[model samples]
Target chain A: SQQGEEDPQALSIQEGENATMNCSYKTSINNLQWYRQNSGRGLVHLILIRSNEREKHSGRLRVTLDTSKKSSSLLITASRAADTASYFCATEHDTSGSRLTFGEGTQLTVNP
Target chain B: DAGITQSPRYKITETGRQVTLMCHQTWSHSYMFWYRQDLGHGLRLIYYSAAADITDKGEVPDGYVVSRSKTENFPLTLESATRSQTSVYFCASSETGNTIYFGEGSWLTVV
Candidate 1:
């Protein structure tokens, strides 16, 4: 079963603009991670935020976790065309032990 | 050669036929996972192994079987291929509590 659900199933934005995607999960989690897939091939790990962390950043990617709301959001600043891909949010439940349940995903298209 | 790879990038099989998708990782990560991606369904874990000789089922393990006899290899088998089993399969591995790396994935079609 899918424990996480991403909002804005699809988003189209112009290059250089900022894009934000939100995810909501059903249960308590130890950490939340975001992954990017281009052309449905392989998935690349974007970033991860622990339950105790309210926000984290890597390059242009920013991730925020709200444990109380069971939700997380990914923000990509100055989005580039190369950043166009399907982004998924996965939650590692408190007791899952290395297992991650993924959300449907958000397809972001960055237009040049 | 330094990362994860999935064999038989594409496969076509008939119902009742048995097919296998192979995954090999050179990182020697203790944790390996198998997940299938389908339209509107996202990716669902099929199975995972914490270490060689130990494996566990995930949300959707109905027609699939996984075996991890070695730390570098994990193979997923379709006992009885069916149309519903058609999907893209991804293999991933990670250190105990680190970021996971994914293979290119195998596209399987059941006719």
Candidate 2:
């Protein structure tokens, strides 16, 4: 199975703080992507980092990928109440024909 | 706006019945996918189509069927639904198989 496993199944933080989630997969990947899902809502794409790329940033979200370790991390800085959501890490393998295997996700709660 | 959409946002069906969840995308993407979300499993792929008339099974394709007769539409059908089939089904599409756009999802209940 190429499924990614996310550490810290749940995280709670106060507003203006940072939240970090990690994902690890056993298989080689072409790219790793992060998504955010609010309760009862569809997932929204956040960031994508290729295997060759070690790190990328999008607004308040920062993603790091280490192919040597087969792990990735997502960090959201200065989180707000509106940023509370479930974060998922999906891995796309080079041989998968674009199929993405997702992790169980990290449920983040930002309190005001 | 160009986006993906799904039909039957919510449905409650009985066992041994047939249910079809419809998915349509305006982007004319060649890749379309069907995934089911559960409490602890996150999202598991059920079926995927690379193009019109080209469909393949995913990790959890059993008890589910999918057809893509048109480039903009792909529908997932469940034959002889079971209680375990109850889940939130999502339809997603991608233009170049990189970034995926997902629909709101359909909540299905089989009793």
Candidate 3:
């Protein structure tokens, strides 16, 4: 079963613009992680935010987690064409050990 | 090398045939997982192993079987190939389950 559900199934933005994607999960989680996948490539881990953390940043990627709302959001500042790919949000449920359930994913297309 | 590796990166099999996708990780991570990626499904876990000789089913494990005989090897097998089983398979491993590393992937086509 899918624990996380990402909003904005698809998004198209111009280069240098900011892109934001949201993910909502069904149950309590230990942590949430974001991953990026380019065309025909394996997924690359972007960032991870623990349940206690409200927000975390890495390079141009920012991730915020709201435990109360069971939701998390990923923001990419000054998006570049290279950032175009399918972004996925995975939740590690509190009860599931070493298991991460992924969302449908958000397909972001950055036009240069 | 020092990361997760998948063998038979691409394969085509006929219906009712048995197929196996091999995964080997040199990190010696205790936790390993198998996931399948489809067009709309993104990625779904098929099986996972906490350690050698221990395996469990995940979200979609109906026609699939997984075995982890060694700490570094986790292989997924399709008992009877079906068109629905055709998808890209990814193998991942993590020492503490906090961060996972994924293999390139294996493209399996069932006809």
Which predicted model would earn the best DockQ?
A: 1
lDDT of 2 by residue, A5-104 (tens): 9989999999999999999999888889999999898889999898889999999999999998999999999999999999999988864447889999
Clash pairs of candidate 3?
none
- Top lDDT model: 2
Candidate 1 colliding pairs? none
Tens-digit per-residue lDDT, B2-105, candidate 1 = 99999999999999999999999998899999999986557889999999999999889999999988899999999999999999999999875558789999
Interface RMSD for each predicted structure = 1.7, 1.7, 1.7
TM-score of chain B of each: 0.96, 0.96, 0.96
lDDT of 3 by residue, B1-111 (tens): 499999999999999999999999998899999999996667899999989998998888999989988999999999999999989999999866488889999999999
Which digits, one per residue and each the tens of the lDDT, describe model 1 over residues A1-112?
Answer: 4489999999999999999999999888888899999985789999988888999999999999999999999999999999999999998885444788899899999999
CAPRI tier for the interface of model 2 = medium
lDDT of 3 by residue, A47-103 (tens): 989888999999999999999999999999999999999999998885444799899
User: Local error of candidate 2 at B27, Å?
Assistant: 0.6
Query: Which model, 2 or 3, shows the larger TM-score?
Result: 2
For every prediction, compared with the true complex, DockQ reads: 0.67, 0.62, 0.66
Error of 3 at A42 (Å): 0.9
Q: Write down the DockQ of candidate 3.
A: 0.66
Better of 2 and 3 by DockQ: 3
Span of 10 residues, lowest total lDDT, candidate 3 chain B = B94-103
